[model samples]
Target chain A: AQSVAQPEDQVNVAEGNPLTVKCTYSVSGNPYLFWYVQYPNRGLQFLLKYITGDNLVKGSYGFEAEFNKSQTPFHLKKPSALVSDSALYFCAVREGSDNYGQNFVFGPGTRLSVLP
Target chain B: DARVTQTPRHKVTEMGQEVTMRCQPILGHNTVFWYRQTMMQGLELLAYFRNRAPLDDSGMPKDRFSAEMPDATLATLKIQPSEPRDSAVYFCASGTGHMNTEAFFGQGTRLTVV
Candidate 1:
């Protein structure tokens, strides 16, 4: 089975400070990780994805995530936070493409509040 | 931008009435997914189709819920005799279903069952 866990339900950070939203996963085969952000009354927007590449992958809005195979973690990070950056973050995991089929699992989500 | 398109951005219906949601996936995309989002349950996959073929619908309620892909671009989800519990924001997403591809999402249909 494939699963995703976002340990924090909420995270608060001051403006211009670095922000980190934690994510971990468990999958039977190689994992494909993704990060998405959702604002009120809007759809989930893709931030970034990790297929197979360097440990660190940069994405939109100056956001980046580091893929750690040993730790099974793909933590979303930002060098500086903005008040507009506040939104709900979701971590999703899918099993590597193969002959088998499994549902994509999404984490419970973490609400980020960037205080000014 | 090229994205998934969903019809009837908002719908309100009485209990026991039938509700239908439609989606048009992105061009050349082979995979389509239907998901329901709520405060309590979060996001739950209702069904998905690949190449206009029904692949997995186990996540949906078999008795009252039905999903089908009439063509490569058109996918539909129907719920007969809907209950208040069925009220939620339903989203449609599209992907290539190939290696290392990310899915694009629609604005979603907010269904309120009164």
Candidate 2:
């Protein structure tokens, strides 16, 4: 089974400060990881994905994530937080070898609050 | 930009009533997925289709829930007898059906069963 976890239920950060939303995964094989953001009353928007590439993956809205195989973690990061960046973040994972179902297991989600 | 579109942005119904949600996938996408979102469960895959064929539906309750892709572009999820516990936001996403491809999500339909 492939699963992902977002340890923090909520994260508070100040504007202009760096922010990190933690994520970890457990999969039987290599993992295809993804990051998504959801604003209140809006659909989830894809931020980025780590299929197989360099460890560092940059995404939309000045966001990036680093894939650490040894640590089984893919943490979303931003150099500077903004009030608009406050939203719910989700981490998802799928087994690299899974082609039949193409189902993704999503984390419970972490609510990020960027105080201005 | 191409995106998946779901109908009935919000639906409120009394218990035991049938509810149906529809989705239109992006053109040329071969795979479509239905998911339920709630505070407790987050996002869970209810069903999915590939090439207009049902691939997996294990996450959905078999008794009252049914999903079907009537054509290449249209998909529908039906609940015969909705209950209060079934209240949640249902989302539809479409992808190319290739390994590692990202799925584009619809705005979702918020269903409330009383």
Candidate 3:
């Protein structure tokens, strides 16, 4: 089964500091990883995705993620955090092959707080 | 902008009452997905359809819950007898069903069963 794990339930970071939201995955075949952000009362917004490309993929709002095949991890990163960056982050994984069907397994989510 | 749209942004109903949520996908999208969001379970896939056909619905409780895409423009998820535990935000997303395409999400319907 394809699954994603976000180890931290909450992450605290200071404004202007780099922030990292960790995510790891388990899948039978190659994995298609995605990062999404959600604000209060809103649906999940797609941030970035790792298909088959370079290790690092940049996304919206100055966010990026690095796909590590050996580590089976796709960690979301930002060079500098802002107070508005505070939100819930979710990591999702789907098997690269079609065998797993169309569903993508999502992580429990990590709440990120950027303190000013 | 092209995006998925869900109706009944907020709903409050007594327990045992029927609740129905509706979604309209993007114009050219071929796949639609239904998901429930809660603090305990996070985001879970309740059901999904491809080409207006039900593809998977195993995540939903079969007894009281039913999902249907009556036409290309409309999709509905119905709960015959809702319970308190069913209170949560239900989201609908649509995608092109092609490899590497990300699903676009609707604002979601917040259902509260008292």
> Relative to the true structure, how large is the alpha-carbon lDDT of every model?
0.91, 0.92, 0.91
- Candidate 1, A13-75: lDDT as tens digits: 999999999999998788888999999888899999998879899999999999888889899
CAPRI quality of model 1 = medium
Q: Write the per-residue lDDT of candidate 2 for residues B9-114, one digit (tens) a residue.
A: 9999999999999999999999999999998889999998999988889999999999999899899999999999999999999988876878889999999999
lDDT of 3 by residue, A1-116 (tens): 88889999999999999999999899888778889999989988999998887989999999999987788878999999999999999998866566324677899999999999
- Which candidate number maximizes lDDT? 2
Q: What TM-score would chain B of candidate 2 score versus the native chain B?
A: 0.98
Worst lDDT run of 10 residues, candidate 3 chain B, spans: B95-104
DockQ of all candidate complexes: 0.56, 0.63, 0.56
Worst 10 residues of 3 chain A by lDDT: A94-103
Where does candidate 2 stray beyond 4 Å?
Answer: A98-101
Q: Could you give candidate 2's per-residue lDDT for residues A17-49 as a string of tens digits?
A: 999999999988878889999999888899999
lDDT by residue for model 3 (B1-114), tens: 788899999999999999999999999988999999998889999998999988889999999999999999999999999999999999999888865778889999999999
Second chain alone, TM-score for each candidate: 0.97, 0.98, 0.98
Reference-based lDDT, residue B30, model 3: 86
**Regions of model 1 farther than 4 Å from truth:** A97-102
Residue A24, model 1, lDDT? 92
Candidate 3 Cα deviation (angstroms), residue A37: 0.4
Q: Candidate 1 lDDT, tens digit per residue, B1-114?
A: 798999889999999999999999999998999999998998899997888887888899999999999999899999999999999999999888864778888999999999
Q: List the residue pairs that clash in candidate 1.
A: none
